[model samples]
Target chain A: MQLTGAQMVCECLIREGVDLLFGLPGGAILPLYQTLPEYPKLRHVLVRHEQNAGHAADGYARASGKVGVAVATSGPGATNLVTPLATAMMDSTPIVAVTGQVPRAAIGRDAFQETDTTGITMPITKHNYLVMDTKDIPRVMKEAFHIARTGRPGPALVDLPRDVLTETAEFDYPEHVNLPSYKPTLEGHGQMIKRAAQLIRESERPLLLLGHGALISGAFDEAREIAERAQIPVITTLLGIGAFPGDHVLSLGMPGMHGQAHNNWAIDRADLIIGVGMRFDDRVTGRLSAFAPNARVIHVDIDPAEVGKNVRVTVPIVGDAKRVLHALAMQVDKVSRPDWIAEIDALRDEHPLYPGGSGGLRPQRVIQEICEATDGRAIVVTGVGQHQMWAAQRYVFKEPDLWITSGGLGTMGFEVPAAMGAAFAQPNRPVWSIAGDGGFQMTMSELATIVEHNTPVKFAILNNGNLGLVRQLQDLFYGGGRVASGYTGNPDFVKLAEAYGIWARRVTEESEVRAAIEEAAAVDGPALIDFRVEPEENVYPHVPAGESVFETIESPAGREALAWLT
Target chain B: MVDVTLNTERVHTITALVNDKPGVLARIAGMFSRRGFNISSLAVGVSETPGLSRMTFVVEGDEWVVEQVVKQLYKLIDVVRVTNLSAESAVMREMALVKVRSNADTRAEIMQLVDIFRAAIVDVGKDAVIVEITGNEEKVAAMIKLLQPFGVRETMRTGRLAMTRGAASGARRERAHTGGSAPDAEVVP
Candidate 1:
């Protein structure tokens, strides 16, 4: 049977086992929407904004371990997806963004909504296609999914001209795509794996710095086994949060500038460091010259570029994280370091300093309450800013893949819709989004999406009345003269939620934090709460950029917090 | 560990064999720009296979950074093979077109310099001459400099094309080195 390009697209998506799509409709994509009703199994969530659609699809992909799909029209609609696409690109998430372009004749002429989306997105995507022929639709869809899901996964975009979608053509989706050049290494070289295991065995004090790759390759069990066998302490990067259980005895929570003081100390003090699936981001490595000065690094990742980009590596193993971890674990020799464990415990116990006199609804207390209420089982998502870091530091992720946040791009309007997508991906699990006042307003439009889908996502607005992270930087770096970071006006979030017809409340004191989280989570449908956190509260253990981790400010009380490198 | 290492900007000629997928060139070039590497010269041509194209580009960076960039090029799905060839083991060449001020008096003098550099005079206007030269970067640079004394009016040069010197063929050969011996006229007039 012959099918229109729109039908062909639908068929290919169904063949790829794609059951959900997030998008907004427009003039060019009307044909695709018209053909959608024929397929009852494919559920489509209409998002208010294109960026939210991209974020929702990305969140869905991360939660479901499947390729997430989003769609939009040309011009502004396509451009709005750029931020989320870049976010997915930077963090290596799998998403396929489909956009309808102006008719073939109108392209590049700026007809109605014509834009060079393929050209604009080339830098950020793993790959992209601008399909002009109806016959090429099936093949293009297959290739887009293949590229987005393989190797170091990232976003891919497909632009379909309106003429192509309307034209009729025979459809035959290829069972398998054989791109001779597109080979992803699945196993580490035996010699390199052996060398890595050897380095781990010989070192008196070994540390495992887990990154996003660990979660991407589903190497959680292998990572745990290797750490337990070799008696190496495990430290995580921001995106690597849930790969290792926070409750594990050897697991040291998030190692960075704002990472746990003990974790940073472990990174600095180790004799050998085994890195799995992570790029040593500049944020994680305070100053490259001073980072892990004592350690010999073994970097394992699917992307060879990441092996030696930020820091030097002693042994470079290029392969999938799970396969390499399994091979390397088999070669590892068992060893116990009583002295190293003692030192790590001492550092953890004595180093961290929390600020005092927080009677108002503190963000840290709010995060802690949510984690306790959910038993760390809920899927926690957050927008970028201080609340993100607070949740990262406070939430004890007892299992892998429970915590999701925009780490690399630090997109502000990510959480609300991303949580909705997460809820859709996993109906059995509870999903909650924690957002700052500044970021919440950026995409509070997603609240309608949650309501329409009736996705039972609990929304927690961390209302600090300012862009907290930027304010922190300005305060410390600009002689405490805060500038444009503060918000001149704000909305009553409780009233905002009530307007959306959702169960809503407000928590002003620290005492009401737990009850508010419990009430919100207990609701059958989506709910929201305004937790007015203390303003001027800052994230501690702050490592100023280009400085050593040892120079971290533990609190805002002393000269260190007030001091500026300039 | 008696090795001496110096930190300096080193130029490397890297060649890639990529499928003739649409936007493959832009994809590879975009990676270079996004990674903040500088491309000194880039020349691409259809390769042995119908659907495959050979790309040769020159990038200058610190030794380690260049190596990392080459590894990154390998990660792109469209790229079939990539080789980073150095100055010693590869046969590299570049072609240049020089338009110099010439008349009955300087035309003969320009021809003498062209012969010494093993170049050819491709075109001659009433008061100008277009000389074409094919050689390594140094040879091409020399030809342009020598023609400069004749009041050089204009010059255009293909960056560099390179390949390895070997008996190995097919897959192993494609990944062996970065340059090709045959210089094309893409950048030259």
Candidate 2:
């Protein structure tokens, strides 16, 4: 059937099984907007900003395991999406960003609303396409979705010229993409797999280091089974939170800076480290030479380039995480090591990580209370900084894929929109965003997006009146110095949330933390609870850069609490 | 490891089928340089089919290293095929013309060497002999090095041209047989 380019785009989106699209229309995308009414199944979310559209798509993709779709007009609109696109790229989120460009005739003429969207996004996207002919729209759209969701999933872009949107083409969606240049390794090499299993089997103390790739590849169950069968303690990167039930006896929780002391200790002592779906970023590994120094590392990742990019891998398995884990599980004998589990349990109990403080109405305490009250059923997303780390460290998630945050990019203002996306994807489930004062304001413009969409997301802002993470780093690393990390002058988050038509509450005293959380959870629409935490509070168990994970500094707060306990 | 130094004189060429994407040529050239292979000359052009480019590189390296280079090049996603025409039944030719400092005394002697090598003098100046020689990459290199002793002034060489033996056609024929469309020049936005 013959259809206009705009109609063809909508049809292609529907054919690709995309039910939701986050975008804001402009002059260059008017044709697409005009044809949107024809597709009733494909819902368009009007975000307050194009950046929020990208974040929303990222959230949707992360939650639903589908390619998140976002659309924008040319020029500034497309440029605004760059931040989110880069964020998604860093985190390996599957996303398809469609931008409307000026007609092909005026491509390089600097026409109004014209921009080099493709060129701007080249570095951050998996692949990109510019549609000059209406006939190419279907194929390009198919390819964009394929490229975005396949291999090491990341964002792909398709820039449509205005004229192409108005042009006519016969609609025929290709069933499969046939790009010889694009091949993603899915199966592990048999020799590599056998070698990895042998290494794991021979080790006396083994550690399974999980990363976001495990969650993205849906290998959480396989990972848990492997750990349980092998009796190996599991440690996670910040992004790997909730990959295995944190409350499990063998689960060591997040490792590295701001990670659980027990988790770090286990990683330091392990004889063999099976790192899955993780790139061993500097933040997670600290000093490379000392990271798992005694351990023979077996690294499994989908991206071949990432195998030896950071740390040397004794055995490298390049393939999909889920498939590799399943293969490993099948080949290894199921045996229970009661001694190893008990040892890990002992460490967990001895170095128990309590919520920041019980006597104070602290953000960390509130996050812990929420985790307890909800039984880890609620999906917790966090903005960047101290609250992000605290929530990651304190919450004992019992389910895989429950915690969401900007890990690789550490993007601020990610939680609220991402929470909204998560809530929308799983409507019956409660989704809460924990944000720090500084990170909250970065992308707080999306509160309007949340309110407009009625996503029913609950938000908890750790109102410490500063960029807590940076300030804490400055204080500890720079001789108690203060920098621009302090945000002394800030708006009242309660008032800001109220202005956005969200229910708001403020908790000041130590006694009000639990009640404030309860009140926020009870609200019908999106709710924001502003917890006025101690301005000087810092996340502890911090391993300074170039230091071993075992060499951690206990925060002053931790020392004070311990002294009081004594 | 078996160490074999392969030094052969023939009309030989190497044909590489690479993804017609950006930066591919530079990657291929960098690979050659990194492997310590001295490239005599190189040429790259769009294949008869679209989305594939044909690159011809003439280089000298240890046989083992050259084999390893072929394997490593195959690892690059953009590289579709690599053909070493040194041993296969093929037509290998290189065009080179050298300008030597040919005064009345040495001109005849330089001409005699060119005749012995079946090389032709394309241009001549007051004090130079421009010899045109078409054969293999080694022949061109040997002629250049040999002429160097005669005070050769300037030299230029067309890398290599190769055709398979009998009716076995090249990449163009393969693409045609596969019934694929020609590669597109326009970049995907």
Every candidate's DockQ is 0.24, 0.08
lDDT of each: 0.85, 0.78
TM-score of each: 0.95, 0.82
On DockQ, the candidate that comes out on top is 1
* Candidate 2 CA-lDDT value: 0.78
lDDT of 1 by residue, A74-180 (tens): 89999999999999999999999999999999986879888889999988888889998999888889989998998889999999988899999988888887666
In candidate 1, stretches whose alpha carbon ends up further than 4 angstroms from where it belongs are A353-356, A558-566, B1-6, B173-189
Docking class of 2: incorrect
